[model samples]
Target: MNLKDTAARAAILGTLHKAIGDELKAAKRELGEGLRAAKQETGTQKISVSLDEGQDIGTASLVQPKAEAAVTDAEKFTAWVIENFKSEVERKFVTSVKPGFQKKLLDQITAAGVAEWADPETGVIHDVPGVEMQGRAAYTRMTVPDAGKQAIAQAWQSGALAHVVLPELTAGGAE
Candidate 1:
């Protein structure tokens, strides 16, 4: 209402805005560092393929193969991997990362003060962020509760997984 009062209010408001901005920046910086560290430390392994001992896709297989049993097993396994690889790899990747993501989400949300997120989604989580509740559910793909897991799953699907499309391997030998 008065000049001095208005000036004082503006100064306080500006300082408050600056402080809030500074705090938010610090929060983001810390979070980024944390994520980097987690990426290094956790380093979730992708679902890798191992040839069955009897199948002979690798060094050992070369030595042991060509028997009727070996050939049949190899053929069956080749067919199986060919048919189910996309889904199998996808499933392994999802399963491996789900727990980590969920734990991260639980920690982040708890720290962020939104601890009441239901134990499980009443609806669906999507690999696509901001797409949950309809369309394609995404985060559920990796089965992780963390937003990072959701982001990673989406990236994995659209990035490497998209490129690889399908993978093949053979196995052989005795064990």
Candidate 2:
């Protein structure tokens, strides 16, 4: 490249860099001012006042307590049910047998999208459904439907499940 081209490119880059730096500084100043305004509006600053009787009220400061996170009874019950029944549901799906009697015992692997059948007497593989001559299978993950949520909710309301209670905190002060 020529010297003129190089100089022009450098000048453009320098102008862009300076513009970006100035914008960043302006943004930081605006953010600091906004934060200060918000703090003052929220009563984070201390204030002192003098009464008519020449009595001075000491510096009064506002103290805001951070809210504590809590879990509800429904959430706890849902967690408990999932922990207890998740494995059982997965096992049932994995070992599920197709209805009706066939000459061969077929185990349907839904995730693999294939029905694996083997003869009991000869112990030979036979009749894979949806398998091509090239032996390629289309696999799909199985998802279990959440059909028990209503039942669980009903059971909880009927007192079949234990209820959970969370502690509540309140702030009190004299005016």
TM-score for each predicted model, relative to the true structure:
0.25, 0.24
| Tens digits of per-residue lDDT for model 1, 22-118 | 6556554654455445445884222222222222221100011111111123333334333433332224422222344435444444443432233
By TM-score, how accurate is candidate 1?
A: 0.25
lDDT of 1: 0.36
lDDT of each: 0.36, 0.39
For candidate 1, the per-residue lDDT at 159 reads 63
